[model samples]
Target chain A: MTSDTALSVVFGDKISDEINDRVNSLADSLKKSGIKGITELCPSYCSLTISYEPDIISVNRLKRKINGILRKEMSVRSEDSVLWEIPVCYGGKYGEDLDDTAKLLGITPQELIKRHSQTVYKIYMLGFLPGFAYLGGMDSSIAAPRLSSPRKRIPAGSVGIGGQQTGIYPMSSPGGWRLIGTTPVDVYNLKREEPILYSAGDYLRFIPVSEEEFESIKLQIESGTYTYKSDEAVRK
Target chain B: MIEILRAGPLMTIQDGGRKGFADKGVSQSGVLDNRSMNIVNILLGNRKDEAVIEMTMAGGDFEFQNETFFALGGADMGAQLNGAECRLYTVYRADKGDKLTMGYAQKGCHGYIGFSGGIDVPVVMGSKSTNIRCGFGGFEGRKLAAGDVVSTGAPVSGITDNSYSPETENTDEIRVLLCAQNYMFTQKGIDDFLSCEYAVSANYDRMGCRLEGTAVEAVNGMDIISDAIAFGAIQISSDGMPIVMLADRQTIGGYAKIGAVISTDIPAFVQHKPGEKIHFRAVTLKEAHKLYRKEQKFLRKLSEKCQKGR
Candidate 1:
């Protein structure tokens, strides 16, 4: 709809090229206003969420203040890339739904894996759970919808694709995403000084590692000695 | 310490609630009637955020295993200590082995029982609240049942005072802030939402209350992406019936939230039992903010009066 409706709603309308101009600028404007009551400022794919003290600024007033900031033009940066190579083991016990997804797309499991790792995905948002990144730019050939009924529990670091989105389960919790592989990355570690392994806007590449390497990385991650490698590779 | 002889429906142990763990998918599950719970805690002179017992529908019988002070608030559940009318909003001293009992609620659904010190349940995820969803926090992460023994951390410094005051049971109406998704419905749907009296369905619990009301039309192919949801958020299900989520609401939801009840009006809703008919009215955000501040001021003054009068 219009910016009027988007200004008031907490979950604004989906991101579009038209609103992209406004979305790109709102971040800088918020910082410039010197607004004081907020505890956190988290920007996502299209919307920005500001958590404020209820005693200071009422919810309604906060909405109005944010709308004022939206009017300003923000500096847009196009060239930004931080490649993260995540080690994944595809089509095994960790990915129980791999065969089903491959059958749905009329392709072999190995072919599905090839297509999945072929494209570099963009971290669109991080909202479901802590460190659970919603990656965009998936290969549409392997695109699939989420499970009709969500599984009771999906293990942490279980990589799954739902519709055009692909993400790793940050924690062992109930989810409906279609699992294709398991990552050795500790996406969220509560005990660690810096919990979230990957922040939003980072590019990710899946490097298919063997089961033995997966186990070795898991122990290293658990023992607090896992050193992630970030090698650059141009799109081929 | 007190021993539960008989507990009513959905009695649970509660405290300040689990916070700062939302990233872990755990919701803050504290007392539903936070204001009343705070009042009872103030009367007992315990830590305002200390764990207490929250009973629903009807209260139960208990025996004071130790000589200590306790208080009751929230619902007008006629309570008795040694068969005598036990007044609320004031601390009462019960001797060791003294039997105390409570009758069916006359006004509200949930009530609070606060001891001088506090219920000393092991904390889980930085709270003593009993989250039934994940079976975490409070008395081994479960509901209070018959023959359950609830102990306190330490006795609070308070004496029995006849100067206790009670709350005026108010069920006028619930105030709400219209949500953004409200426009998804038609004008008639909005009118029906504010005018039609909804009955609290029997399917009520700490998670949410499924309401039975006028059947509104659910727009065809209307899909809502998962978003953050708070307590007292009225989410319209696919069937167009309203469901008011409570303290144990999920962190995020995919349903269309028509409106969120004003924060201060939560206690009023919590006091309502199943089958109770209540009407909702939309108020300007300005009015909501003013009312919230006014309520806070009134509570502070009332509490001060209670302390001085005692």
Candidate 2:
């Protein structure tokens, strides 16, 4: 369904691997088409919003162009997607709300961490803030609701959970999610050619680490010696 | 170099804005009233995308260390160059050590000041516009303040005495094109939205302009899958108040958008002050496109005239 000016191509009503892959494939083709007047192509969980200039191309003409591209049936390129293993320290000062969140879920802090790190999550989209990835795939048993009152400042690299979704805070900002852990890696560094570490459709696996390991990794990152591992194989 | 003596509220350097970054969740932060910004740049024969200082309701005081040609546009902010009254949409030469001061806006909310050679700021993500929320782009990724000196690019020739004054229209009527989610609103809701008069709420800013009026409730709920937001998206909050998203709005929003105000009319809409009554009128997409093309034609002719005045 498209707006009068912007075109929003929705794949399905639910969030599924098939839908995400289709969305990614469609986005890739539209980008490869090199359509003129397209200012931005914002891809979310199940839809892609194409913001274009009406002066350069009328909305009806652009829609027809997009429809023609869709009819060509592009396949998702697995090479474009990457799988990352992020290290996290899930307790103590780094995760201020871990114990409270675990108690609310009727589970021990260790159990909560185990459940969170065990699942391979998918990066549904990046929104709310710059480089903040909206992640999917979390154990329903450990689902936690957001805080009634949001914090004034949640530190950067904080892994949090709100409702059924789990994500990492790329930058320090006010948030209502319950913080469960912190990552030493800089997921959003503006100095890099690609500011965001991950893109939509990328897979993420959290690996539990100790506070001492977190500090050591933080030092390694500051020294520019830390490098993240990426696997080309896409997990089903 | 121009040094800020008194940086007024919410002053920032802006250009055409950082495009192609919305996919990464970056807002396209730029001048609120782009028409005014373009006119100021055109008057000085500066590049269309040259960065200019966007002043809000209250303007500021600055001292130039060198001679440079400058132009002012948009709101009548009572600008004075070296203690002499300066007019909007007119080019003026400022001598070394000249002090330029401006008072509160007399009519509209935004005012623009353009230098002969755009304001020199490092382009981040391909834009000089400031996104204060993300703290990147524009002068150090923030608003201008006291004691800050800003550089200017090399001046271009062919600066003319060309002046443009946009024809003032009825500010109360804002034209909108129905969006994809128009079916979500009941007929009564749609009628109420078009018929009722809305006042600009006090809680308006570069991000969005909130309007206080009769609730335009959706037949269905207001929640929807998050989608990209355009410059003039009219999103209805859960409370049913309409918020016209602007340049500094987030790249995407979850609220159901009823429609979008046409691009050509956005300049006049932004100039409106809080507590001012505004009404909406529906226009077909074709009509909206025609208005946009007409404005582009006028701007092209104006640019040509300025170039010929060398």
Candidate 3:
């Protein structure tokens, strides 16, 4: 058995699927094993970074311990999930790149919008910035490349798709993702007891909302009374 | 109180560092050169986490509005008290109206000036370190300039000669850890990364230091997705040169990081001014940890010695 101090190691390149499974398993392991020193475990597509106290266990040895458990890792069965319905108003003022993306795909803007919104995407990761979600499972027909030059500043809650991945920018930042729509839902709110609206492994379904509904939801969120609901996950 | 008579580009006040704030998308904005920052604190007989002034490569001039003791460390910036040459990593006394001028840095880019009692600055997110990205901590979230007067809390004593001097083995060659992403590059790329000499580009700051070197290429087929990045991670850009992210590096990145400059070597690497050639050689994570632990031990010893001196 490897010492608790050894650093955990994961194998191979592009181990996204396996990495995600290992992360969920490790969370259970930490709880059941009563492990000490770990303050947090942040899991990504390919790696899980466990932040711990140096005095408890040095990073060098901790990495080895992680690699040890990964050798005989048990498969992580999918857990019950709450499907979050995000209402996004597409095109016109909300989406600046919708028309250009439609032209590139050689399809009408309405067709592009319908194709883009049809699928229920999974939030694979939440990173790059505060509250930013890396959502996967987008239609390839409407897939578009990032802008040659990124916009200097993209507003918060700007829903966009880059290549096959779609995401909602949770903060104002420089982004290359082609903006297709805007969501009034506050993806991140510091004032809220829980700042982030979505977490990794959650499901997100984009439901088209009217401009009037977008305004009403925005005001409700600002006033702090917007209640979010979850639905049954579509079985694989 | 000490007044800035002249301030160079990117000069700011710094303390130990601000850690544990990455979840908020805030980088650990602290003194880029940690060794020198610690040395400055030791010279003044101050605690390890005391606030100190961090000056960049260009140099700056300051005046003691009141008689105070300060110590210089990090770069051999040729600091002078009233036009007299002073030694690096030693405490010196300056009286009121005495102007201290910093000449061009000879070996390093940053120089630290730690006051006797340490500067009294409001701590933001549990640090006095300047965060230039979010514009939050240190001097109204901005760099220092001429005429800015900073006050110290209380006076500390300058004691023995050893307490006023630096005691550690210093080297120029920076050691690093070969990253897991090293396989993304070709064999020649790895060879070039180790053998080829690179100069520090002028496009450098707290965020990262870009190296101007021979093109380091990726393998015929390898593309990397963004992942968790830390301080000292040497990320090779699409243009093929390496950029070592420093205090204010983004929490995550997409660029392939072939290696990370060991934490111990980062102080020296930060001191190398533009046009100075730097070479890279990789070591195991154990070796890297050894180096890091060695520095920490040295720093603790230095602090202990300083405390005993007073």
Candidate 2 CAPRI level: medium
Considering summed lDDT, which 10 consecutive residues are worst modelled in model 1 chain A?
A: A1-10
Q: Please provide, for model 2 over A1-236, each residue's C-alpha lDDT reduced to its tens digit, 9 standing for 90 to 100.
A: 34344668888767777787777777778888898888788887778888777888888778898889878868564557889889999989989999999999888999999999999988877787888887778888888889999999999999999999898999899999999999998998878778788877788999999999999999998888888767876674
Best prediction by DockQ: 2
| Model 2 chain A worst lDDT run, 10 consecutive residues | A1-10
Q: TM-score for each prediction?
A: 0.79, 0.96, 0.79
Give each model's whole-structure lDDT: 0.73, 0.86, 0.74
Lowest lDDT block of 10, candidate 3 chain B: B158-167
True contacts kept of each: 0.03, 0.47, 0.11
TM-score of 2: 0.96
lDDT of 1 by residue, B27-89 (tens): 669998888887787667666678888988888899988887888887868999998998767
Across A25-59, the per-residue lDDT of candidate 3 in tens digits comes to 56445545545666544445655545554555677
Instruction: For candidate 3, write residues B1-310 as lDDT tens digits.
Output: 8888888886898887776444344456788988777777776777776888888876689899887887788877788899899787767778899988987778678888888889888777668887765565788778998989999767775443544454554455777777767888998998998888899999898889999988888985334665656668888888898998888777656788788787778887998888888888777766766666777688788778777766
Candidate 3 local distance difference test against the native: 0.74
Estimate the lDDT of model 1. 0.73
Backbone clashes under 3 angstroms, per model:
1, 0, 16
Candidate 2 residue lDDT tens string, B170-277 = 877999888877787888888999999999999899999999999997988898878778889899899899999999998878898899888888888999889888
Give the winner by lDDT: 2
Candidate 3 at residue B232, lDDT? 80
Would you list the rank order by lDDT, best first? 2, 3, 1
Please compute the TM-score of chain B alone for each predicted structure, in the order given: 0.93, 0.98, 0.92
